[model samples]
Target chain A: MFGIRSDLPLRRDTASRFVVWLVMVLVFMASLAVTVNSYIGVLIDDWNRSVTGTLTVQIPIAAAGDKASAILVNKVLDVLARHPAVAKSEAVPRAKITALLGPWLGNSEAISDLPLPALIDVEMATEGTEAVTAVTASIKAAAPEAVIDDHRVWLNRVMSLAQGFGVVALTIMLLVTGALALTIVFATRASLAEFAQVIDILHVVGAKDGYIAAQFARRALVQGIIGGAAGLALYAPALALVAWLASRVDSEVLPDTALPAAHWLTLAALPLAAGLLAMLTAHITVRRALSAKV
Target chain B: MALGRKKAEEISGDAVGLEAVGLHYDDGPDVLKDVSLSIPQRSFHFLTGPSGAGKTSLLSLMYLAKRPTRGNLKLFGENVTQAKRGRLAAIRRHLGVVFQDFRLLDHMSAFENAALPLRIAGVGEAVVQRNVNELLNWVGLEDCKGAYPAQLSGGQKQRVAIARAVVNRPKLILADEPTGNVDDTIAMRLMQLFVELHKLGASVIIATHNESLVARFPFPRLHLDRGSVSILPPLASSAEFDHDDPRG
Candidate 1:
């Protein structure tokens, strides 16, 4: 598969440079998307394992009157603290809640006067969704009007983003694969046209159509490998910079952004995969082109 | 080799048999009309024709490069008029053709060019190198073995093409003006090589415009004019091809 010698002068063609560059750019984007998609996989697993079952207990100011809302929060916190699954429980101070709303409404003093729900933050220790159902009854017994959020609001949004990005990355790789195949076909035909006379001579010398096609296949394979390696070289640094930026973000919703070391080996194999793709595509292209002759 | 799934010697009457063959390009007048020919195995013939006399076209047919537009064509006694492409390539393996343009691959060295046929036949590298070196030396191209076509002279390129054609020792040898670019001395030497192959078991057909060169070989001639053929008889007294003579 790695044979280099060929009867066609494909190396002399200027289109090789164009093909190599196109493949390089395409492979770089594909590697980046694929690696990011890989990292997102870890993030999705983390979200499912640790974050999906966490809950928030809220006492709306409307359901329980403003003064009663404060009392209802105390009952819920006591109920959560007594539960076996609850790892920690705390009531969010009214001043802190008002401060969080300062960005959209006004200053803390202006927003503090308004009615707002009493919020209790609970961290559940267990990893199963059953933990949410087990504690729901206890919290409701303490305060019947208590609203329990399994944190599904932001959890579903982030989960959707991760899965959506994975799908988008997959689509990008598909487009890259299609474009790479087309590039090989066009380049093979151009190389074939450039060496048409040489091929005719090979035919006269009793060389089979497979022999001639193999020469072009080798050329395309070489181009694919070189271009793939170069593209991966560019992608490594780009991905590192992205990981660094992602890790630096302070949002609580973001998952661990560090990529594992073993994935580099998988990414390293992309060059050979690209080479095989180029070889197969080129072989089919040349055989079809030559079949039309005489 | 026969065009069908048959061995070379299994089905045999003539090496080549063409019955009322007609050919033409798309929507064009017939380049060859009602062309009928019968050449026995191991026989040598010269194809003589004017510029547009379809010598190369006829050679193309004999080597199975193209099928006749109409009528029956046979190689090694197998009818190939309706044969498959793979069958045509199988038969082509036994036929060697030296094109008029000296279509040597510009990328390959002269030695590689000559070794191409043997390599395609799945011969080992050692045998390819030995036989190619021997043949290149015979064509007086021993020194230029490592040279590419672009680096070699016109006559040198023609010699490389000839070496490539004959290196396989095929059953039939066809050349279109194989000696067009070389001097009379080298030309005669090259023709002597062809005659040697003919002496062994290969049928040979050479197309040429040089009458003096034709006068030296005692082979029968197939003369073509206006898309038709006429047979020319050989000389009454056969003359030997002198190996040492500069002018034979």
Candidate 2:
């Protein structure tokens, strides 16, 4: 006789099922967006560290063949090595250069006929664009046919692309949160309307508004937790599939898709936060709706 | 402080009191006008009127569901008209109401519906079980305790409503058409239940148009007509009560 019984329907009706499914999908998308954004941020930082404070020098191949071009490349390397801003410099091997072009130019006997430029790789000790400028002048003076390429310009473009991706990810997360809130609001209002008589009976029986709101809030909290868990459960397999597909590609083409163990904790909190949001939203909604009634 | 406390003690003697209370819907005509009356502690009264005569409206005021548009209302000596929304729950908890339409929660069983008032009052589980079981047994609903509202007959639903109203042993009971849908035997049994409640020091106010039932019991009645109310003595025939005359 003292057992607690639910005044509202306990079944997985259409409206409630729809709300749970919608919340799950929205949370899944939000989690994916946030994870992707974090990965891109890490990639940008890694790329920036590798590309900054570095320069590449290219010497045009002379009609006299590899002997003349090699002389110009060594002269450019000697100039870079003597410069105060240059940390270290080395002449790139012809085999390494050929391998760099191997993806584009096939390893056929005819490939040897094409005249490729000799290259020098340089690492700078001093920071700033001015240091690069000074080293470029020194290399040009030493070898007139040589061209200096400071990677900062290309790095800036890549950083801009990463920033754009971050912005898009953030916007998608915000949209998902908004859609989740609206879906909850709609579902909460519909539940309140459907159970108006039950609510009125509670009211007449001396149950406070908080008591009535708590009933709804508790139901919403349970649904939210279930939906959130379902979304997160599907997320693991989806992430694994993505990592698998990414592993099949060349590492040079794609950034590392594997997330750190610590990042998983953050992703795990998403569903929990969604559940709390649903509970709080339902609490406020039910109270507001009850206050409007007689 | 002593004088104020004495005055409060004196006011606490009344179970329900209204001072020139008036009620209206929006800007429409008054449903109840300048009605002043007091039900002494443990008194029982039948509120009688034709359909649309505002019997339910007057009962609404008594149960704290609706505040009078103009004038003061005191439930168990508390100024409920001036009470805040949060304070209303505390005051309402001391009063029980049986609705005319039998507003039972369809999803809940008869036992759960009967145990609602005690649960709301935060009674302990053991006490709730004991009191609710005994009350259901008295109401002849012990066997149907597991049955939901949809599965119960109209008389059974009415009994569940009554059990809920009295479960908390409230200081006052306000019932609207408590026996309108039941058979004569069940109706007599329900009236006997109200009498038993009154004997336990709870003032009972039952609104009904059943003249035979009114005649069967020696309870005073407050007759309402054209937005006005007049008190009639116990055992007084309703036929002798004039509808047009304010002085009855």
Candidate 3:
């Protein structure tokens, strides 16, 4: 609309519309990849915080009537409480510990007859492995039978998996951007060829290369916006369905998939970015084609 | 016959000046050669020749559509043979060309096709509307303003092309066989439109082989034959060559 309103026809054929739809699908894929990556990052952070600087002390059942095991557990708790690096220490009640193992060991009479260790949960005042190591040593000196489990091995494995997912998501985003740019270039060349006579008329009428390029750029930008919005519309409902499904599942098994407000805002910017990419690609292509003419 | 009356009174600067200009296609034979002439400002001339006489090629040079292979050409007093491509558009804006094909865009209506020049020049919308409407009406196509080029007859499309050429009141108009597709009556009407534009201080050049039309008008002639040009005298009166004209 900003250009000279001539009878010069714009692309309205099926081929052109297919180009727009292709761009929409590419943008949708890119947005979905980024959103998934963000969610993975949140999950990793949650897992890390849940495990960092925390230790579980387990004392095996004593040869006597459970009195010796209770005394060893009290000795481990006393050592953790007095340690400068310890924040809070609590003895896990037998019922709660039994409930934690209910899914694996079952709640039948056989589970009650089995010899179970007394467990003490310890929260450390300082983070990192060094503090946890020092606290473990102090606990071990008091109760030799106590074993300290800091959860570092499992945390490392989860982080490694999250990083691998991040790499894949990044690769997907790059591929989508590349594909969108190529589609725009192809569409511009096709449009230029289709309207060759119209371009000649415009040139004869004294329209400059910049002016012609602006016409194409404006048209491509509008198409980009429409396609981008359509892609986002599709992504939104899919994201909602995924969130609903995630909510129905147990959070301990699967981290919460619902994206935060900041991540949604980030995804909202995808359409605008797509529009800008389309405009720039169209402008460059048109100018390059016109430069070859008289 | 009055030969070069305007050329004799050449006190004013020429609208177009060519000195030994030549043109040829890529690795092809020369299409135009050694053409030297000056068209004084506001004068009307007819370029007459047979087909394949490089009439369109010569006009293409005048409109900056092609650069001459050799020699100097001045348009509106500026040396444009070597002008940069970026600067050529400004000079081209002062020229209006009517192609033999009647190049009206098929997508635009008659009014929009005619309004192209003014719009390209960034004229105000109100002025473009008024000028385009008045010109369409003057060309006798006011009723067809909303019609596309495909919907119009040959004569109507030619008229639309002419209207587009003069819409911005260009300083020079080069029409290549503007009436080639129309009847005698429509051709004469189109010539009259050019005459009116010439009277308004625009130099006009019409390329045609129709001797009858040339004899009907006493304008000077730049006759081209075998890639060469010669300036011929204007007929003393329309009656002198009216009987000898073959196209009559």
DockQ of all predictions against the true structure, Cα-based: 0.58, 0.54, 0.58
Candidate 2 lDDT by residue in tens digits, A132-179: 889988888888778778887788898898899999999998998888
B67-143: candidate 3 lDDT, tens digit per residue: 88999988876778988766677777778999999999888899999998788878999999999998899878979
Candidate 2 displacement at residue B71 in angstroms: 3.1
lDDT tens digits by residue: candidate 1, A66-111: 7677677777888888899989989989888888888889894657
Clashing pairs in 3: A7-B108
Alpha carbon lDDT at A86, candidate 3: 96
Write one digit per residue (lDDT tens) for candidate 1, span B21-67: 99998899888999999989999999998999988888888888788
Candidate 1: interface RMSD equals 1.4
Clashing pairs in 1: none
Off by over 4 Å in 1: A1-3, A60-138, A261-263, B1-5, B8-11, B150-153, B239-248
Candidate with maximal DockQ: 1
lDDT of 3: 0.84
Sliding window of 10 residues with minimal summed lDDT for model 3 chain A: A6-15
Deviating ranges (above 4 Å) for candidate 2: A1-5, A12-14, A59-76, A82-85, A102-116, A126-146, B1-13, B182-189, B216-218, B236-248
Q: What is the interface RMSD of candidate 3, in Å?
A: 1.0
Candidates ranked, most accurate by TM-score first: 3, 1, 2
- Alpha carbon lDDT of residue A54, candidate 2? 82
TM-score of chain A of 2: 0.86
